[model samples]
Target: MRTNILLASLVVLGFACQPTKQKEETASTPEKIAVPVLTKAWETDTVLLTSESVIYDEFRDVLYVSNINAVPPTAKDDDGFISIISTDGEILELNWVNEISAPKGMGIIDSSLFVTNIDEVVEIDIPSGVIVGRYPINGAKFLNDISISSGNEVFISDTGTNTIHVLNNGDVRSWLNDSSLVGPNGLLHQGSHLMVASYGGNEFSRIDINTKMRETITDSIPGGDGIVSYGDHYFVSNWNGEVHFVDTAGNRTLVLDTKTKGQNAADICYIPEKKLLLVPTFFGKSIVAYEVK
Candidate 1:
C-alpha cells in the first residue's frame, strides 16, 4: 500500500453519490451494466496496525492480513506481521507469522504462502507456520502485491520502481517494466491475462501472459489499490477509501466511499462463493466486510 504521507496531496476523488444510476440511452450507446449494491456486513475492531492487504484462504477458511508496522512503508523494520482472521471479522492471530519485514501483498500456492516484503518475496509453510524460502529481487525498491497463476508462477508488483517481478521455477526476475505500469499495485491473474491496477494514475490495464501485449481497459480510477472480478464487471478500490465498479464497457460507477470518514481502503479481497468484498483500512486498522448484491 502507498503510505498516506506520499499520497497526502492527492485529494479524495470519490463521487459520494448513488450507485444505481443509468445513463440516458442513445442509438450508439453501449449497453449499460448494472452496478452491484454494497451493504455493510461487519467490520473488525481497530487493532490491525496499518493493515495493507487481505487475502482469503479457501482451504483454511480464514483470512490473512498484512500489517506494515513501520513509519515509512519502505522501512526495513523487520517488525511487519501477518494476521489470521475469521470470515466473521474476528482476528484469530494478530501475528501468525511475524518474521517478515514490512510484508504487503500475499498469495498462496498449495501449502506455501508467498508474501512481498520491501524487496523480496518470503514464502511460509502454512501448515507448519515456518519460513520456507526467500527470493530477493535485485534493484527492487518496494514490493507491493502478489498474484499466483494456475501454473504456480508467482507475480509481484513493485510500486516504487514501477515494475512487475515474477518467480518462475526457482528464479526471481523482473517480468514487465513498462511506462504504462505507473505504480502498479494490485494484480489479478485472469486466465491468459493479468489485470493490473496502477496507483500513480487512472490506469487499469490487461497484459497478455504469453505475448506480453498490454491493453488498457479503463483509465478513470485513480490511486487504484485492489481489484476483484464480478462476472464481467470488476470492483476496484482506491487507497483514499473509495470503491468503484467497472463494467465491461469501461464505465465506472461509485459503489462505496469512506474517505469522508477518514478511513483508508487498501488492498481488498473478494469471496465469490460468499459474495463478500473485504476492504482493509490502512490507517483505520480494521477490515470492513461488504455484502455484494
Candidate 2:
C-alpha cells in the first residue's frame, strides 16, 4: 500500500511539473488602413476618347489629355489627339492638336509640348498648335510616357522594348536599354533622379540618370501606371482602377478603388497648388479629378 501511494504521488508530481499551455498571439496583426479623403471633384464628359495621360500645364493653367481613339491602342491611324481641359472639368479644346497619331504623353519645354507616339517623340509648338519637330527612336516598338526636366532634357519610356530614350539638345538616343527596367511606364523627373513605375511588375524605382543605378522604393501597387510625389507622400495609380497613397516610410493605404465599378486608372497627374489628382480612365473615356488632402 505504501508503494502504491508513492507511485500515485509521483504521477501527481509529473503532472504539476509540465508547462502550462497558453494560446500564442500572432506576430503581425493586420493593420487598419485609413481610407483617405477622396472626394470626387468632377468627371469630364465622354469626349476624351481613351484618355491615357492627363498632365497639368501650369504655364497654360490647364490640363492636357492624350487620347487614343482607336480600338487597338497602338494604332497610328491619325485618330489620336490631345485635348485641353480646364481645372473645373470643362473641355477647353476638343482636339487641341490633331496631327499626331497615338499620342501618349505630354511634356513642356519652353513654348513646346513634347509628346510620345508609337515609336517617336513629337514636339509641338504650344502657341501655334503645330508640329515643330519629330525625333524618331528607330526600332522602338511602344513609346510610352514622357518626362522633361527643368533643364529641358527629355526622356521617354519604351514599354515594348523595355528601354528609356533620352533627348539632350534635340538629339534622341537610347540611354538605358536593359530588361531590368521591367516595363517602365511612367517617368517622373524628381530633382536629381528619375522615378520609374513598372507596369510589367508591381514596383516603383528611382534611377540615377548618370550611373544608371536603381533603388526600388516599393513593390505594392501592381500595374502601377502613374506616380507623383508631394510632401514625402506618393500618389500611385494602378491600371486596375485602384490608387494608393504611400508615404516615404513605405506605408500603403488604399486611397481609391474603382475596380468594382469596372473603370480604369491609367497615367495620372497631380496639381500641387490645387491639391488635385487627375486620373485618366482608359476604357471609360473620361478624365476624373479627386481632391486629395
Candidate 3:
C-alpha cells in the first residue's frame, strides 16, 4: 500500500514538472539556419602585382595587400612588400610596408598588423605603417596564413611542413604538428574553434580549441587558398580563381569563378559591416570586391 502510494506521488510530481521541462526544451532549441548569398560589388583596379592576400581595416576604410613580387613563394630575398588601397578602389599607397620577404597572409591585433613572412610573424604599426618587429618560428618552413583568436593568441599555418604555430606576445612555438593538419594554408580562428583550409590536401577541417579534437568539414575546395566566415556559412577561395560557399552540413555552392582568365584568388578578406569580400588575385594582380547578398 505504501509502495503504491509512493509511485502515485512520483507520477504526480513528474506530471507537475512536465510543462516546465517542455518550456526549457523549446527555449534551448537552435534557431533556423540562415542562407546567405553573394554578388560581385566593385573590384579595385589591377594594380596589386603578385598580391597573395588582402585584409580590410574598416576604421581606416583601407585594405592591405601582401604582394610577393618574387617568383617562388619560398624565396626569402626580401622583394615582397605590402600595398595599401582605399576601400573605394583608390591606391592610397602602393608598396606601403616594403620590408618583408614573401608576406603571404595577415592578421591584426589592436593597432598592429601581423603578416607571415617566410618563417616569421612580422608586426607593423597600423597608423604609422612601420615595421615594428618580427617573431621568428624556430623551424617553421613556408609559413602561410595567420589568424588571431579573441584572446589575442596568434595561430599561423605552415603549409610546407604541415604544422600550426602559436604566438603569444613575443613567444613563438610549434603548437600542433599533427598529420591531420595536412598542408594547412588558410586559418580562421573563432571563439572556441580553429578552422583550417588545406590548400595542398584540398580539405576543410575544424579543430576544437579546448579538446584539440579535429573534424573534417569538407574536401570540396580544390586548391583551397583562403577562408572567411559569414553568418552560418563559410566563404572559401581556391588559388585557381574560384570561390565556393560552404555550409555547416558540407553543402557547397560555387559563388565565383575566374579560372578561365588564369587569375588566382589567393587569400580573401570579408568586411561584415559593408557585406563586401576582398579577394586578392595573385597572378591577376588585382583586388576584387564582391557584395554578400
Candidate 4:
C-alpha cells in the first residue's frame, strides 16, 4: 500500500510538471517568419514645391499637396492652398484649393478632398475647390492628419486632445484616446489597421479598425509626420526629412534622405501608377519628388 501511494504521488507530480515543461518549451520556441527589405530601385533629386502636406489619388493619377503659408495679396490670413501635381513632377495646378486654414492632413474620397484645418474636418469639391461642408470637432484644439478606411469611415488625429476621432457622415466620436499617442500627426489606413505617426511621442502605432487595440510598431522616428502605403511596404517621413520604408514584418530601413532644413518634411504620398514618391516640406517650403524604380 505504501509503494502504491508513493507511485500515485509521483504520477501526480509528473502530471503537474508536464504543463510547466510544455509552457517552457512553448516559450522557447522561435517565431520563424520572413521579413521584407527595400531594394534601391532608383532615386531622383527632382524637386516639386514648398508643400507642407501631400496625398495621392490613385484613381485620378495625380498628387494633391497643401502649402501652409500666406496666400499672396489675399485676405486669407496666412491660409494655405492645395496643389495638384502630375506624376512627372509637373505642377498641374498651384492653387487647387484656396483659402484653407493651414491645411495639414489631406485625403481624397470620391472626388472630394477632405482636409483637417485648425480643429475641423472640411470637405471640398476637388475640381471647383469649393467648401462643401465642415464638421466641427468638440474638445479638439489642433487637428492633424485625416485618413479614410475601406468602409468610408474618416479618421482624424487630434493633436491637442491626444486622441483619434472617427467621423461618419458628420457624426464625430472618439476612436482612440490613449496616453501612448501624443501629438498624432500623420494617419494612414492599410488593410484593417490604422497607422498613426505620433509627432510628440516620436513613434508610430498600428490600431485595429474594429477593436481599436494599438501596438507600437516603431519609436524614435523623429519628427514623424507623414505616412503612406505603397505596394507591400509602408513609408513614413519625418519633419527631419528622412524617409523610412517598413515592410510587412515591421522591419524598417532608411530609404531616402532629403536636404531640407528645419522641420522640412511633413507629408508623403505614393503614386503607384507613376512609381513616384511625393514629399512635402514644411519649413523648406518645397515639394521634392523621387522616382521609386
Which candidate leads the pack in TM-score? 1
Candidate 4 residue-wise lDDT, 99-146, digit = tens: 676777877779788888777788988767788988888888878888
Off by over 4 Å in 1: 1-31
> Candidate 4 — which pairs collide?
49-286, 49-287, 50-285, 50-286
TM-score of each: 0.88, 0.86, 0.87, 0.78
Residue 66 in model 1: lDDT: 94
Ranking by TM-score: 1, 3, 2, 4
Tens-digit lDDT track of model 3 for 1-293: 99999999999999999999999878865555555666777777787769999998767788889999877988888988999988867888888899787999999888999999988899999999899999988788889999999989899999988899999999987878887666889999988899999987789888998888888888878788899998867998988999888887877888888889877889999999888988888988888888888
Q: Whole-model lDDT for model 1 versus the true structure?
A: 0.89
Clashing pairs in 2: none
**Candidate lDDT values, in order:** 0.89, 0.85, 0.87, 0.75
Those runs of model 2 whose alpha carbons end farther than 4 Å from true positions after fitting are: 1-36
- 120 Cα displacement, candidate 3 (Å): 0.9
lDDT of 2 by residue, 159-184 (tens): 99989999877898888987977788
| TM match of model 3 to true structure | 0.87
Q: Which ten residues in a row have the lowest lDDT in candidate 4?
A: 40-49
In candidate 3 the C-alpha lDDT for residue 170 amounts to 91
